[model samples]
Target: MQKELLKWLKDVGELDSARLISECSVDLLYVDTLFEMSSDRMTDLMDAQIGIPGKYYLKLQLDFQKEIKIIETQLMEVATALGMHIRSISWNPKIDTDKEVQMKISIIVRQAIFDEITLNKISWSGRLEEPDFLNRIFDLSKMPSFDSRFDNAYDDIHKHRIMNYDWEDDWVFTDRRFNLLHCEEEIFLKFLSLTINPVSRTDDEGVGQLIEIYNRNLSESGIEFYEKSKIAGKPIYGYREIAAGNASTSSADAKQRKIALVVGCSQYEFAGLLENPLNDAVAIKQNLESLGFDVMYAENPNLKDLKIKIDDFGTELEKYDVGLFYFAGHGVQVKGLNYLIPVDANLKSERTVEYDCVQVDRILSHMENAKTSVNLIILDACRNNPFERSWGRDLSQRGFAVMDAPKGSLIAYSTSPGKTASDGEGKNGLYTGELIAEIKSVNLTITQLFQKVRKAVMEKSKDTQVPWESTSLTADFYFNRK
Candidate 1:
């Protein structure tokens, strides 16, 4: 890329910085006023003799000792923005002119052009200012704290138009000049990507946090900033356009919009207490959290409080793209409706038990109301209801009623409808234990994730318990995609 940029620069022979800016349509608004003045100071900076078109070299005074690093970095940026490369900066030395003797540092460089991909490959779509994403950037760019970052971005991507333009509070007076606020999508994305790079962030925590904030908005435009790798615990960020319905591996991490809620009702008040529900909830919660979900966990929650948590979770789900609900406890089915027994339930009779317990459909209702991109409802509560003996119910079905999964949802059952699932002799239930194990595997989509769990459970249970899923999912999903 640097070679090509240099070649492009060489083609435009004997060019001055002003001409380069005007021809290339660079944006100069982001440049510091004093530095912009220097660029404007044609007599000292842009004169052809000093900024000579020979193997990329820069000539600067050695007087500003303290600001030397700052000035050198900025000048190199100007050199770069003008499609030129200033390779190295050497100390001042005696110059041999017929009538003068002075010291001036010389840095060799080659002419350059902005990357072709950044300049012409991607055409401008809508106005760059149309998205609110830039609002944060614009505000931050003007702050004193962010000077270290925006300084590099400004000089790295400046443009030329009128040789002398007015100024307003550091803004270029001529709106006609190309500026950061009204550049192409390519430049906007490239500029933003540079700001979040580990080198640009001064090894601060801002890179990670900013990437999260940027990706949330960038994804709406079919692009995202991803952590390409890490350097000393800091993320090295990059950007790419994402295909529709197919998010990248970086999209599968915590920066994306995803959340989970896990509940366990083991400590019963009037119903038979179970052992593995709490354990199962913890297992699922841990796995989901590890897979980049903001998991909300509930243990031994009562009907009233659980309902409130469900409502809150639903409201919160509005802000996320994916939502998951996992429940493990004693469950009962009557008249083809499933109920999850709460720790505070009083199941005196089959008729009133519906009022005492939590309905499975209520959870689905909240997920749907939130309008999430995907919803997962996993039920490990297909246990025998102790009330069946007292009610004298003698049907073949012993567990939850069968139902179809809703649109954009995938519901998982610990056992096929109307079958019982063992709470297990170990810390976790037979179904949840396998599910957690499979969730740790990367590149497994939602359906594939459950299929593996079903197989694992089937083998472990010796075909006594078969996990099942009902999915109406419109897009593929991964718990830990790579």
Candidate 2:
């Protein structure tokens, strides 16, 4: 049986079979002995094997109790064949012997992809042995003339569009290569659902083109798009950190200071929720900049832009003493996993989610590497899920569930879990309205101000909603501790 199972596994590409066979151990064995082989040479061993079933298969009569044992044995055999290491096993004698023994099993495999795959850490390079410099030209079969290319003679022409043909092997090619490299990086990074770090490999021109390409691609899908610009004269990065007791600015020349990233993504990114967060992100940039910090602010950014913002924010994090993130829009927690809704996210199926939408952990992972003094993740994106129908189909437990926030970080939710918050029948939602009203109060500390904001919003909503927070704060945090 082991040999057969090994062969089956080997025929496929599943190398895990070898490991399972090496640690082979039988689990959940049941038996009712009644052996009758061809001319029992086991007549002497027959009496002893009466209560105990023999290991080898022979003429076995499966009685009521015997059939139950047979079924259990078959289940164990199947489990072993499938390369499952059983952690626990059980048997039931009370179950009806005449009734068929059903096998219901669950298999879980934990494969570590993030830790094992050293992404973006390795750079690839290759040099061609020789160059074909004869200017190899192909026969332009059924192709159009260069003169009438655009409209007249090119209706059915399938061609590779090389925008900058002159830049194939020159200085422009080098720049274009960098641009293409950044573009490729953006594509792969999107696959991993990570933000791009702008400063890792500095190419202002390359990155700018990359952003243009990303947005242009997104626009083809009928999605409305906007790219964040630098504030005043300074460029904006995304969510970052500062020490709790520290100020965003110092008394120094302030010219040497680098502002943190203030990035926001509210996939629920409704036109309604857009203005407040965008305004809030802008206010955050201005407030931080006034204190001598160089701010990188992004609002309602799509996935690619968000990744770029995150990457840029990460690179700038080491240069700053403070960081902050304020997201206002629609967010949902499914099976305890949080997701930031994008404006175009129509997640009707679970299969489409990881690719089409953004996961909160991806955002947090980018921030996890920040070297700043404080990291504050403020999520104002707590509203009822639009895909409420999906919740019922995929979950036993309803509503969004909380995930463990990263350490040394303070996470504030717009509303408490399992509770729905108002979408602001007026201009801003109740939460954002209160937040905007309270955020500028220099008299209050960050935490105290949050408490006040939470109280006010809760009271204003008539106890229908209440804000929540989860913090693993190492020290005190204050917007104006001094």
Candidate 3:
């Protein structure tokens, strides 16, 4: 790329004639006026070196003695005009002497410039602004304090295009630009976005079809499975996984054969609804460990912390043959995307919902990539959000729903999509109570358990609240049926 740029530079004009300064250095300089610079100043900074017929390059730099905030403000303006956006920033600090700091700064700036030029949405014409005079305004308050701001700034720099993308384009960020910015021969390029294509996903509709399958197969033991009953210590058909695995592993000194993660959130501020999903998590953990499965539990994890936990679990997932993720909490479907809420989630806006809450797809991505042979996700989170209650939205809205569970995975929801589940007045949820009953029964596959749970919940709720399941299991699995 540099070779091409150098060649392009030689053809346009004399190197010194265009006020071009190659490898220019600055000292004790600070740039504070970048935020308030006019458009002409930016034009001046463009250094006006034409490239490849009509293209241009702007060599920009922010020095150590300059205020990062000022530099950021100026960059944003240029990015907006040029139809560029910032994506992210990864920085390494220099703790050595002043000279080392300066050298590191130059390297960082040069690398950033190279990256920007090579980026699909941006082109480097030349040094539009001088680095020498611009480095003197080092006001410190313009820098960001948190990592998110810096990351956002970089994202903005990389992303700020005037146009949206086309449907046929690859959605992968690394493959192509999300925005289009091309220069016409007359320099009449306008960053205009194309219309967005409608989303074609209809998986939510499939949940209803799945419900019919369960209702049709409700009574007969189409696939025999069950939880153990306490009174007779006999296995009953349709037990949840945690119960069977927990019971068998109890007395054995050997490591538990399977591991389960139970996540729950109940203390919703708007409605003040509480079912103690955490308490259920504790119960499930203890009972599962007793039966032979190593149980790990997290209750109402902060939204900020959930991803870290998920990532950590992703690594540990390879350790077990079977991986189970169970979530019981409030869920909401927004803009066609499903979000699992943390106790701290405050989604006042649709955009906020997408970023802060855990997306159903992200969880699937981790699980599908995991090496575990069996991946089971059990969600009992179908409570309604209080903030949207007054908006006249359906109260029957179920929590998050997932589609297309991978070939080795099973996804069970507490209630059908677009329907709400009841928080049992009893110790556990109605579905969980039945789940606890069935899991104690040995020799049940997850498919059978889900089918049975669908039956029990439908029957127990008088056909009002139906459970849902999506599975692509390739092998039979049992906690204690053997």
Clashes of each: 10, 25, 59
Candidate 1: regions farther than 4 A off: 1-255
Q: Across residues 1-482, which tens digit of lDDT does each residue of candidate 1 receive?
A: 22222334445442342333222211122332223454653211221112222222243333334334443444465556554445454433323456532111111110001221232332111123211223334442342332243343232222111222222212321121334433445555565575565444443333433443444444334565555777787667777666545544445543668888899889887766688889889888888887778999888988888888888898899999899998999888878888888788777778987788878888899888988888999999888776777788766658888877788998889999888889899898899988878887765556657767887999998999999887777555767766
lDDT, residue 343, model 3? 77
Q: For this target, which candidate reaches the highest lDDT against the unseen true structure?
A: 1
Worst 10 residues of 1 by lDDT: 103-112
Q: For candidate 1, list the clashing residue pairs, or say none.
A: 21-160, 26-159, 27-159, 55-109, 56-108, 56-109, 56-110, 57-109, 83-112, 84-112
The per-residue C-alpha lDDT of model 3 at residue 151 equals 42
Q: What are the per-residue Cα lDDT tens digits for candidate 2 across 1-482?
A: 23333344455544543333322322222222233576532111110011222321133333334543543344345555544333334332222245532211111110112211223221111111111110111123433433445432222122212332332232211121122112232222232221112323134333332333322233222221122345454333332123232244422223343456665544343323344555555655666666556667776677677667767777777666556666666667665677766666767765665766667776567667765556777777766666766546543333345656567677778887666667676556688678767765653445556767887997998878888777655444445423
Q: Using Cα atoms with residue i matched to residue i, what is each candidate's TM-score against the true structure?
A: 0.49, 0.43, 0.47
Clashes of 3: 59
lDDT values, one for every candidate: 0.61, 0.47, 0.50
Quick one: best TM-score, which candidate?
A: 1
* Decreasing lDDT order of the candidates: 1, 3, 2
Q: CA lDDT of 350 in candidate 1?
A: 84
